[model samples]
Every structure is written in structure tokens, then in C-alpha cells.
Target: MTNPCASEIFKELSKGSRNLTDLTGLGGIDIFPGMLDLFEQSGKFDYKIKNGNIDPRLGGKTDIINGVLVITLSNDYLSKATSLSVSRTIIHETIHTYLHKQLSYYTRTDLNTFELLDKYFKTKYPLKQDYQHATMSHFLLGMAVSLYNWHKNFGPTGGTLGFDYYYKLSFAGLIKDGTSELLDEAEELIPPGSSWSDIDKIIQNEATGNYESKGEKCK
Candidate 1:
């Protein structure tokens, strides 16, 4: 139950935190894993770069991890995340710190990784192009990541009543995470009861562009 990301705890351990060169350089953790504070709309987490949960100064900065990050995420996160989500986010940001420590440019290529998605969906839209120009695919991927994790955990037993409840609950996060306004508009475009099909379509469009980029485009 220790708040490892707290500055008070950090100051006792390290003399002071250093500025990371970029997001990729951050790695290591001072905070105890499996720890959490009550999640809140106004609440934020702080991590020291050398070791902690989240850097408090990462506010307003999308690509760099030089300063601390105060991640005041949307309320949408509540539905999809359990303690597990926090763990994953912690590891994710940690990787950014580690890589950014040695190099420039935090790893962003994977942020848009849409490999083999087109063949799965098969669409006419340029999902990859849209992904590059707009953050649409990023939203989709983030939603997919959470969904996939949830499914991986409960998907085997046809899911429990509790699991199903959680899935429906997270539906809002699916929309809110990054795809809200876009999802709302797109959901309207889609007919009810075929949401999965529509989601596939978007993936297909994106995958096609991805293959094209490799010069080995899929048919």
C-alpha cells in the first residue's frame, strides 16, 4: 500500500530526480508494484524518472518524457482498468524511460503498430493514412489493447457473469479512451448488433496501408 511514486518517499531514497533526455530513457521503479491510490477524475499520479509510478511533469507533453508526468486521465479509464491496468501502464511508461535514457525520441512506432490488421478486416478506407494524419488509430489501438487484455483474462470460460458485467462497463472506456467523439460519430454510421463487423472494417483499412508501406501490400 506504499505510494512509491510519491516525492516524499523518493527524496529519502535519491538526492533528487534527474531530467530524462526523452520518454524512451525512463526505466526502473521506486514505487512498489501492485500498489494503487483510489482512482479519481481530479487525482493524478507522480513518478520519479529513476523509479516510480508516473512522472508528475508529463502534463501537456504528448511525445517527450523529459519531465515528470501528471497523468490526469479521462473518467473513461475506470471501466476498463482494474489494478492490472495500472501495472501495465507503469511498465509501459517505464520502457519509455529506459529507451529515452539512451536515445532520442521515445518509441512511437509501436504506438501506431497496425501489423496484419488489414487482412483481418479488409476495408476500402485508408486506415493507415488516417492513423498517420490523425490519432484515430491510436485510439483504436489503445481500446484494443485493453479489450484484448480483458478478454485474455476472462475469455476462456465463455466469460463469467462478472466478466460480462465488466465488459459492458468498459464499453464506455472503449469509447472514451481516445475514440469517443470519433466513435460516437462512427457508431451512428454503423447499424446496431454488428459493431464487431464495423470494428473489423476499420482494422482492414489500416492493415492494407500497413502492408503497402512495406511494399508487400496484401490483396
Candidate 2:
């Protein structure tokens, strides 16, 4: 939780209380290995990095086919992506993978539950057609952690901008008001000053119908 990236803004639609520790729980374990446990009881998880012909226009992609979570990242992005950016990409796809699994599970159990989950995510996340922007929120979140770690270890290597060349290249203008929007959305699920553990508890509550909605959506 002490990781500086834990404080990076995920959403900021409102100015009041926010829960900044949502991603900190993820900081403890290597984000990749953590993917295994998420699917341990459910199924298998795997990934690969494609170098040669990845469309230069694309950064990364995630697919869950026949119960396997597969992540594909461009070689160019791999070569240039900072540890934090890489982690961000992994985590972003992880969210998609998790939501997919939960949606499917709920669908089998009760159609209403599946509909609720679908409606919930659609309101929070951009649709698949807007995939880049959809995941851009997570990329910035990861960059916040990376930038924080960079400062902690090496100090502003990028000079005045506080990040650096690679991070700016990957992120740039994709962050306008995104962090606030995400944090504002999360605040409904998490209370101010909550830790990563608290956020997780809320997610569990959500799955069990213990969580209530304040009826807010990202702007």
C-alpha cells in the first residue's frame, strides 16, 4: 500500500472523498503471477508477447477462449513499455478477463444477475469498440505507480514533466479527466481512506448483492 502508484488517480468525476488505494493491493504480488490465483479455482491463465508483425498501431490485447486468459502485447510496446506501463496493461486486461468470467458465471445462475453485472460494467467502462480508451484509464493508473516508483528510486529522469520519454509516448493526451472519472466511479464502491483490502471487500459485497448503488455514472 506504500507504493506511490497506489495513490494515482483512477477516476475523478467529483472533487470530494476518494479511494486511492484500489490498485495498491495489486502492488504486493507481481501482477502476472497474481493472474494465476485469480483463475486457480475457476480455470487456467496464460499469455504471450508477439514481436514480429504486431500492428504498430496496436499496443496490447487480451482474449479468454475455452477458459484460458491470453494476453498479447506488441514487441514494440514491450521494448519501450516501462515496468509500470506493462503492469498497467496486464491489470487492465485482467479486469476485462475477470468481468467476463463473472458475467458468464452469473448468466448461468440467474439472467437478472448477469444483466445487472452487464449494466454495471457498461456504465463504468467504455464499450469494446472503444477498447483503447477503455483500457487507457488503467494505463494511466499504472503510469502513476511507475512514475511514483521512478521518483522513489531514480528521481525525475524526465526532467520537468516528472515522467519520462517512454511514459509520455505511451500515455500522452489519453489522460484528460480520466483519472477523476475512474476514481469518482470507484468511490461509489469504496469509501474514502479505504485500503486495497477494503476495496476488495466491496467487490465481494457486489458479487453477493450486499453492495448498494448510489446510482452514479462516469461523466
Candidate 3:
């Protein structure tokens, strides 16, 4: 039950830098609004944006309950993050919805396998509600940011405007304050193969603006 739309959005967004004029034909953020529309109309989920303090660690979350998928984004995130960064959050939550839906269809045998994996994660990480899947989500966020940086030509950290840049700056500050342990733990779980080095190579290869025709290899 792979989500082709999600895959396609990732592919398009991975293309190199473009301006508003460049957004018209394709390979631009314009596709985002349409994708959101499609997802909403599909009747599989309801989306909500709330303004309030969300858990500082989470910008967005997706929950599937009683046959309804609910995607919630923190109001603080909406108020502070750049449009592109917010779009990335939306994309992240969409993928979560897709993955969760895919898992819900699994047979009991598959459920057993997932339970075993969960137990293994609990034994290995000793963390509650945070483990491999969280790491995978971070990796996905990395994938999204890498694509964004490449496509938008973000300088060093992120474009001058956005939570992406602010988040990186905040990371540095967190380190100075001796509170980066959580960030460090999250960074450590970026799946060995999907390391930033791998993403760097991807950016280098697509520097020539050839990503439009490329298939997603990060997943």
C-alpha cells in the first residue's frame, strides 16, 4: 500500500532551485495545496491546525483511531515556521498517515512481527514512545529537508526565512546550554545508511538540476 502521491511529491520537491515563475509547469511547491486537497477529500482523514503550546519536541502528529485519521499541527509551529518548513511538516504527517494505514491492513502474523520488533526496541533503547519508528520519522524529515535545501538552494542551514534555519540555530544554542542530549539521541538514530553524508551526496549529484527524472532512493 505504498503511497504514490507521497512518493511523487517527494520526487518533485527534490528538484533543484526554482522561483515563482519556475513553479508553474511543475516541480514546485504549488503542488502542495492540491495534494492536501486530495488527501482531505479522500475521506480517510481529518486535518486540524491548533494554536497553542504543543509538546516542544513535536511539530505535528498523526493518530488513527476508530477508522478516522487525524493530523494535528501545533499552532506555535504554524505561527513561527516558514511556509516551506510547514509544508515539510505536512508532508511528514502525510507519510505517517500512509504508513499507518498500510500497517493497519497487515495480518496477525505481521502484527506479531511488529510486536516483536517493538519489544526489541524497548529492550534496546529503554525509551517509552520513542524508538526506531521515531528515528525513521526523523530520517524522513531529513529526507524532506535535504530535498528542500536542494530545491530552494538553502544556504548552509536553511533559507534566510523558515523554522529550518531557526531550528538549526536553536540546536547550536541547545548545545551551549547543555541540553542537547535529546537532539543528540535523535541524531544518533538516523539509520546508518541514511546519514547526512548520504544526503550530501544526493545533493551533489542533483546539483545539475537533474533530479526531476530521478526515482526516490532514500526510502
Candidate number of the best TM-score = 3
For each candidate, give its TM-score against the true structure.
Answer: 0.26, 0.37, 0.40
Q: Rate the local accuracy (lDDT) of all candidates.
A: 0.28, 0.36, 0.38
- Higher-scoring candidate on TM-score, 1 or 2: 2
Candidate 2's displacement at residue 30, Å, is 24
Residue 185 alpha-carbon offset, candidate 1, angstroms: 6.0
Better of 2 and 3 by TM-score: 3
* Whole-model lDDT, model 3: 0.38
Q: Candidate 3's residue-wise lDDT over 57-100, tens digit each?
A: 45566675566766666554444443334445544555455445
Q: Quote the positional error of residue 8 for candidate 2 in Å.
A: 23
Model 2 agreement with the true structure over 167-211: per-residue lDDT tens digits: 332233232132322343223322346543444333222222232
Better of 1 and 2 by lDDT: 2
- Per residue, candidate 1 scores C-alpha lDDT tens digits across 40-92 of 10012333433223333221112344575322321222222333233223323
Question: What C-alpha lDDT, on a 0 to 100 scale, does residue 14 get in candidate 1?
Answer: 25
